[model samples]
Target: MVSIGTAEIISTHDAYHSSNWPALKPSEKKEMEKRRRIGSKPPTCEKKCYGCEPCEAIQVPTISSRPHLSHYSNYKPEGWRCHCAP
Candidate 1:
């Protein structure tokens, strides 16, 4: 069986000006703005794995400090486990 895993930036920290907000797409920027207006703190990032049976799992990394999104852009899921079923 073949399993495919994908990683995506779900939301960024509230430290907008200090992060890579300027480099984000227009749509992403809009979403962030909306979240901020609603006083919601978005996760740093998200990851998921998909198998033949459509199994789903979510993993969130821990951020020791408020780093730039640029750092997250290069994040590596070294020890992540996929819960996809065969």
Candidate 2:
């Protein structure tokens, strides 16, 4: 079984500009990295795809961030560089 509620969301795409956001201190960065690496199984069925399973899971590894979708595939990350938290 996998749990999806772990990290707190800090910002959104519209608000996430590197210069304006608060920088992650080394300790905070370390903690976030630990949280990001904690592994879990994938969701049985993705929110974006009613029937399709998620194909990948990667960590964005910049402070504490979720996957960014460059293109829409049921609103989930598709191919490379997709940092999808399980």
Candidate 3:
């Protein structure tokens, strides 16, 4: 997980999908490490809404770093987990 401004989002690379995942910047990586090490609240944690049309329709504002560097997405505050089962 990494903290971008105010929101802390999960950062992952699915090797099964592609091997070209971008690498994190040294500074950003360091900051993410610090947050993970500190075990902070992630600044935001919301319930995982599944099959809720309205909830899915509401998109909170977000900021994205360069796709060539950081590939962060699907930021669930802290406790929320994807309800989608495999």
By lDDT rank, best first, the candidates go 1, 2, 3
Report the number of the highest-lDDT candidate. Answer: 1
Of the two candidates 1 and 3, the one with more favorable TM-score, higher being better, is 3
Query: If scored against the real structure, what TM-score would every candidate get?
Result: 0.21, 0.25, 0.23
Total residue pair clashes for candidate 3: 1
In angstroms, the error of model 3 at 73 is 37
Question: Against the hidden true structure, what lDDT does model 2 obtain?
Answer: 0.48
- Across residues 1-86, which tens digit of lDDT does each residue of candidate 1 receive? 23347644433344445565358898988996787674224332334442245444435455545565547577543323345545
lDDT of each: 0.50, 0.48, 0.48
Leading candidate by TM-score: 2
Residues 17-80 of candidate 2: C-alpha lDDT, one tens digit per residue: 5447698799998987777774543433335444335534443333224345524334432232
Candidate 1: 10-residue stretch with minimal lDDT: 42-51
Ranking by TM-score: 2, 3, 1
* Pairwise TM-score winner, candidates 2 and 3: 2
Q: What is the lDDT of residue 36 in candidate 1?
A: 63
